[model samples]
Target: MLQIGLDAGGTSTRATVVTTDGECVGYARSSGGNPISSGKIGASSAILDAIESALTRANATLSDVSVIVAAMAGGSADDSRDWLIEPLADRDFTGTVAWESDLLATYFSGTFSSFGYAIVSGTGAAVIRVEDGQIARTSDGLGWLLGDAGSGFWIGHNVALAVMSDIDGRGPSTALTPRLLEALGISTEGARVQGRSPALPRLITALYDMRPVQLAQFAPLAFSEPEDAVSRGILESAGSLLAHSVEAVHTENGPLVIGGSVLAQTGRLAETFAARLAAQGIEPAIVRVADGAVGSAVLALREAGVDITASVFRRVTDSVARMR
Candidate 1:
């Protein structure tokens, strides 16, 4: 028998088809599947499209699958399942279906352990404690406005604020100013030609016109010039906040899976987070994951009563990697 694993995230939806023995047979990706962002109808359509494409690649149908495990961004909400139920029913799916937060899928992607902690720092940030493949507790997944302290949005917002302050003669100058201006398609020379006085106002207008999360576009500027004191300070502060979030949910030593762009990438933020954890004597086996679809597949295998030995985990990872 075969199983399907689905990771329905804010940016994309991915589906993986795997045999009972953990070999990945097919995979496919589709557009964003977050109901909160894309609306239920759009998210469901994207998810179904990804699954159908993956099944087609595997030369199989839902009837050949024993189970499907979907790890979604807003999977815990009361109406979240509504995004999938009708679509799956229409496809004539008869197998068992399971739902979980994407956090769990990310964690299992890195390790087979049922107990561990997960830290995600992409456009938003969150930390969770996993017990028996479920979230036992969580911290700081409040989106770009209220929280997400160490996220890309947090870093980018700080970058924009720093640039504004610098332009207004209230903050120190840094390399990020020019870089951010270029990234925004704002000609610095034109701003200067139009008179430095109007530059700040123009920037304010541009910033206000964008969706708040679009601020995350400037996050990479922090790493562009690693020696800039202002950028360094921002990253350090972000790392501290992430460490604190991890501390809030972490209780014992188990694999600590860190994913998402900010924390998974090897750079200042990841280094600072590791240093802070070390300072607190909270070292655990650290696993980094770039995608959660494989983990979702592993969860589907587990639901089908397959034991996830180290060799089995390696088989799944190797097969998925080859497919990619």
Candidate 2:
């Protein structure tokens, strides 16, 4: 029998099917707008559609699946689980169905065990600490208004504020000023801020579209001479935030895995993160999960009672390598 896993995020939904032996057979993606936000029926339909597409690609049907596990950000919330259950029920998924936050799934699936911490930085941010198979603590994942300190939204928002301040002669000059202008083709702050600035949207889009390539280019902007102050501050500050979260876990042994596009895109962030983690005596073993979709697949296997071993993880990782 096959097992299925779904990693659902705010922006995207991904599903993967894997055999009991841990070989991935198929995968699929769809937009992840919340059902509550998009109307319950619409949200449910999008999720079901993604599941069906992935199952189809695997040359398998829902009845062929022995177990299903989904890791969704904020899925522990009752309302979120409610929105998901009826959809899975509609599909006749009578086998075990497990729903939990993506953070735990990413940690367990990546580490192949049920302990460790995960820090996720994306459009938003949160740090989850799991100990002995239970959630121990979670920092507020409040959106941009209060939290999300070390996230893509935080970085983009700060970049915009810095540019605006520089344009108004209220802040120190930096390379991002020129780079942002060049990338956006904006000649003046007034043109950008007043003209319904296409520059802002383009910058945000670059975060998701150009991704690591574009972020790599911006890393140098963080240091002075050989450094750019604005970029340096962003990396340092974000690293500090991550360290703060890690400290919350207070565990000495870890396979601590970092998630989200921010770490993948910005080497400076990773370097800064390493330094910060070292200061706290936490030497993390980093493994990039690519999209965390495969990790989702592994969780399905675990739920299906398929015994996981080193060889099993290697098989899944090998399958991912082939896909890349």
Candidate 3:
């Protein structure tokens, strides 16, 4: 029997199928699958389609799968599980089913066991404290309006605000002004805000209108030039904010696993994060979760009765090394 895992996020849904011996058999991808935001039908359809496609690629069927792990976002489990399972069951999936937050994918990607804390810095950010395979506590993640201070959204929103302030002569100019305007496809010189700027484009309006996830795209500006005061300030502030969140739920034991696009990269953010962790005196092992598929596969394989030895994880990691 095969093991299958699905890591569904707001941006995309990924499914992978592997054999009992940690051999990659199939993989599939699809668009955003956030059940909470996209509705149950949309989420389930995306997830099931990916799984079905993976099965087809592997020349296998639902019945061949011994376990199915689904890591997703949005809504109540009670609200979405039936919608998620009925279709799979209709296709004859009689395997053990597991449901979890997409964040768990980051955790599993970082560590084989369910121990350790995970700090997410992707579109939206959150710090999760995991104990014995279960989440113990969560810090921040209040979305863009309320919290998520150190997340991509936070950084991006700040960048946008800075740009607009500079345009209106309310804030000092930063290198991000031109780059941000260019990113938004805005041809108007951002400095025209003090003059006769007629009907500002939607790109300018996006500073107030774009969704939190969309705004998060600007986070890269803060990391572009680490030596710049604006960039350095944002990066260091992000590190400090994330460090505070880590302090809230950090445990004495277990490795500290840093996940998400922001912390995963080797830039100012990564360097400052390391410095902040050192300042906190957290000398535990630090791990990076480069791929969510690896973690999701590890979780499902274990449910399928595969031993989670280090060598096993290494094999699984190697199998999906080409994933991108």
Candidate 4:
């Protein structure tokens, strides 16, 4: 028998087919499948596409699978199950289906342990404490507008503000000013020669024309200049805020699984976040997961009555790594 695991995110969706012994046999990827970000129809379509492709590659039919575990970015929402039911029904898959938060899957990706902490810092930021393979508590997963203080969006939004402040002579000048202007397709030399008057309006207009989440495009600029005090400050602040979110859910010793672009990049933000944790004498085993689909597969194995011993976990990780 086999089980299917799906990790559905705002940027992409991945499906993995694994045997009862926890060995990955097939894998497939598709576009974004977060219903909140990609809409119900689109998200469902992406998930179904990945699953069907994976099954094809495995040379198996849906009937060969005993269970499916779906770890979705917005799976906790009231109507999230709606996104899964239609797709499964469309394929006439009647096997057991389980829904879980992507956060939990991320934690499992880093370790086989059932208890740990998980922090995600991509376009959004969130922290979770897992107990017995379930989320015990959560902090700061709010969307861009309200919270997500140390998210990519937050850092980029701050970058834009700093640039505007610099142009208005209200903040110190930084290298990001020219880089941000260039990124927006505004002529850097023209902005400098024409003065702040002409540049401010254009910058504002260009920024306003974008979707709020699109501000994440500017996040990389914060790391473009290592010596810029403004950029350094932004990263420091981001790290501090993310650390606080972790602290809010901190408990006894357990692995700390960190993922997403901002923290997994081996840059200033990740460094500062680690430093802050060290400052508080809160040190735990830290693990990094670039993809959470493997974790979802682990969950599927568990649901299918497989004992996830360390050896089993190793087999699963090794097999999935080979597929990647």
Best by lDDT: 4
Task: Choose the strongest candidate by TM-score.
Answer: 4
Candidate 1, residues 184-211, lDDT tens digits: the string is 7775444354446556766888999999
* lDDT for residue 271 in candidate 2, whole number 0-100: 77
Write down the RMSD of all candidates, one decimal each.
2.2, 5.5, 2.8, 1.9
Q: lDDT for every model?
A: 0.87, 0.68, 0.78, 0.89
Tens-place lDDT per residue, model 4, 1-324, is 999888999989999999998889989999998888899889889988998899898899888989999898755555647667867877788789988889988888889888889999999999999998889999998989999989999999999999999988999998899999999887534434445557888898999999998999899999777579999999989999999999999988899999899887667777889899988877989999997888999989999899889988898899999987
Q: Residue-pair clashes per candidate, as listed?
A: 0, 7, 0, 0
Q: Give the range of the ten consecutive residues with the poorest summed lDDT in model 3.
A: 190-199
Candidate 3 per-residue lDDT over residues 172-266, each given as its tens digit = 76788778877877676445544734324545675667665688888898888677677777888887788888888887767777777888767
Regions of candidate 4 where Cα sits further than 4 Å from its true position: 188-196
Q: Roughly what TM-score does model 1 have, to 2 decimal places?
A: 0.94
Instruction: Put the candidates in lDDT order, highest first.
Output: 4, 1, 3, 2
Per-model TM-score versus the true fold: 0.94, 0.80, 0.88, 0.95
Per-residue error at 58 for model 1, in Å?
Answer: 1.4
In candidate 1, which residue ranges exceed 4 Å CA deviation?
187-196
